[model samples]
Target chain A: MQQDAARLKVTHEGDIVQVEFTSRKILDEANIAEIGDQLSALVEAEHRPRLVISFAGVDHLSSAALGTLITINNKVKNRDGQLRLCNINPQIFEVFLITKLNTLFHIYPTIKEALESLRSGAQTGRLQ
Target chain B: MRPVFARVVTGTLMKHLKLQAGSRGRRESREKSVGLWCSEEFPSQMAEGRRVEEKILSQCRKYAYGQRDLFALKLALEEAICNAIRHGNKSTPNKHVRVKYRITRERIDVMVEDEGSGFDPAVLPDPTADQNLERACGRGVLLMRAYMNNVVFNSVGNSVMLTKFNESYSSSDTPINSTTVAFG
Candidate 1:
């Protein structure tokens, strides 16, 4: 399955950190339902300005993905950090539009844009 | 052709024909019946029911004839099926939940049956109240009633049958399509 090859890579650059959770479709909600608590613990430990969600591997998303993203963002904000999504595939983007969640959080075409915006302090609620 | 290969080819062709014929019959039957039927084993063959629900939504949304009505049906069906899995059977493997869907000219019908002991449907706490909104739980059953045109609990809460009506069907006489399914 696509999720079997998925990875959540964690890397840091001097107080700047990027943690990405990559997954495929069947891994969508069941993954969140299973790992949400683990994500909560991880968010509680980090203090950073940006979190990147590489949607390169995702096939489809649903209300569960939206809810999970929102919950994680809340957890990050509690730690004074923000969540950014990057490399969103077309199928998942369609869902984002359908749900009108494109308005909820920062999104970028690539990780470079996300990091650059964060460093430049273009602080905003959500970017299309 | 090799005997085994020939058999395999014939078998696959027959299966494809059966499925194609089944699809046609199902479409024709649904014109009047508007019902979905399958065995409890269907869930085990698949991972979860929500994905199935979404597929059904996309397939049947046009039949709903209105976006809001479509959305309501989607939400109500999700809650009903989720409850059938979570609350009714508590997601227990030992228990089987059977779902049957039917839509008449006016009303949509969904019947959910679980193998577990029944409960009182009346005692569910209201999730819309101020105190319950943020808890992230307890809203499934209430939302079912909110979106469905009607809700009925059988002799016990082990089974629930939900119904919704299209306003058009009520105002004008709707012709029921009469067809029996053929799968050969």
Candidate 2:
């Protein structure tokens, strides 16, 4: 099967992979699935892959997108990697609060903060 | 590839009309105050679903729904339509999902129904539970309920109704609170 077009813009800042969504809305199931696959591949390609996903330009996200994030977080954890999410707007952040996912993932207000936390090995604990 | 037509009143509105007349006999009822109503059915495909969603959002823009309201409706509508397509219809190409909505100055009410044997929403596992937090699914209904003012599931569960009051509309008589209710 042909691969779907990449929905993420990924950059490498040292060992940490910085990812941003190319679309304003990450609610489409196919797109979310493709993004999950792409992120999973990135995690599988390296040892202890450190990832930072930024929701800077994103305006809306569905529960499916959140599910994909959880899956990616689990994959990173299984590989002994770290993942940090940042740049989430208030509306999207409300989703995390409502779902109680705010406690599960490491969230930061900006990419610089996320990078700093990753480098300092802070907020690495996962909810059991 | 069903043709979508906006600006038409729906049967649901007529039912509301009767209820309002019998209850309060008032001219300011929601059914009589609607600015636009859209009812359409689309094939069980994500692309088709998205097209309908955009059309509805465009109609909402005409009413000047704020960015926050638009964001919440978009998120909730996506979840409802996705559930109708994937879980309710099992993504069968021949099946269809019916979407009906009414937009008023105060709120937007939407209904999405699919052609499949429905499951009980009560049986859904809580995605927020510690053991289930890492699971990759079952959060759609939760998000819909959280963002919308009210979410209702029909007895069979093949259909869902979502409503969100405009931020500026501060009427204390909200028909339903921000929670999931089961209706026949």
Candidate 3:
């Protein structure tokens, strides 16, 4: 029904929902909305209550995409869920740091680290 | 197929290239300014801004713009386009968004115009403010102003022009100032 996980890859790892962007760069306006909707649906699918957006494949993303992240973060917040972002490239990381979004998100350096945090309920801000 | 010849000239010399077609000759004069133009009707298609940005970035590289400036311009231009599309046009497919970027050795000037009614930049709440930090889309204008050397808006507020001067390296390839960007 959902493009067979075309835009992003969704997987479950021990009660953690990991959403991986399929594109190397999610800079398009139309794609941003699609991503937001997909993440929202994931939030609604079952009661994982823990989400992690992996940027391992992404290099660049526009501010609109950042806005989408904010929307998704807010949605997760409202649902009493936790969202973690990991494997963000340096350039994209600069955007988060510039906008001070680094403070709002629990960012990890790797997907494994993020998963471990989710399992252990550890909160981290920015990857140093 | 006939071969096309391109020449590179320095200084203020007027360079002309002659293209031969049959018995006629066409003389093309090279201009010093490099520019990119794009127009989209709202609700605009996805990645239109990114496409325009790619073109502008290519032009910047062709003009030997420094990487720092190129990155700053990319961010500033993208933000301006987003503002025009999302705020000025309100994502209405009927309205049109226009973007133009003119880059010279001295500076890069970008203009973004939208069909929607103008807005008051003065009235915009600071996106970095504590109360407004979580807002979805209020930081575009601020980023543009922060990254570009000069940002000016028309009286109607539907159009904005951003300018960024070349840092250190001018048309003569000499360092003027090391400052890459300025905040206002």
Model 1 per-residue lDDT at B141? 66
lDDT of 2 by residue, B1-184 (tens): 4564544764766665455444644456534444445678888999989998898889788777888888888888899999999999999988999987877767788889999999898999998899988898899898888888888888888988888888855554544332322224
Candidate 2 residue-wise lDDT, A26-102, digit = tens: 98888888889898888999899999999999988888899899989999999998999999988788899889898
Candidate lDDT (C-alpha), each: 0.57, 0.81, 0.70
Model 2 residue A32 CA deviation in Å: 1.2
Candidate 1 has an interface RMSD (Å) of: 6.3
- lDDT (C-alpha) at residue B127 in model 3: 71
Task: State how far residue B138 of model 2 sits from its true place (Å).
Answer: 0.4
Report how far residue A51 has shifted in candidate 1, in Å: 1.3
Error of 3 at A24 (Å): 1.8
Model 3: per-residue lDDT, tens digit, B1-184?
A: 1122222332232111111111122221113332222233223333665667777678778777886788778878778888887787787766666665556666676677887788989999877676776788777877787778878888899888888876635443332221222111
Residues A29-119, candidate 3, lDDT per residue (tens digit)?
7778888888889888755479988998786676788788888888888888899999997877887777777887899998998988888
Ranking by lDDT: 2, 3, 1
TM-score of chain A as modeled in candidate 1: 0.78
Question: What local lDDT does model 3 show for residue A7?
Answer: 85
Candidate 1 matches the true fold with a TM-score of: 0.51
Worst 10 residues of 2 chain A by lDDT: A1-10
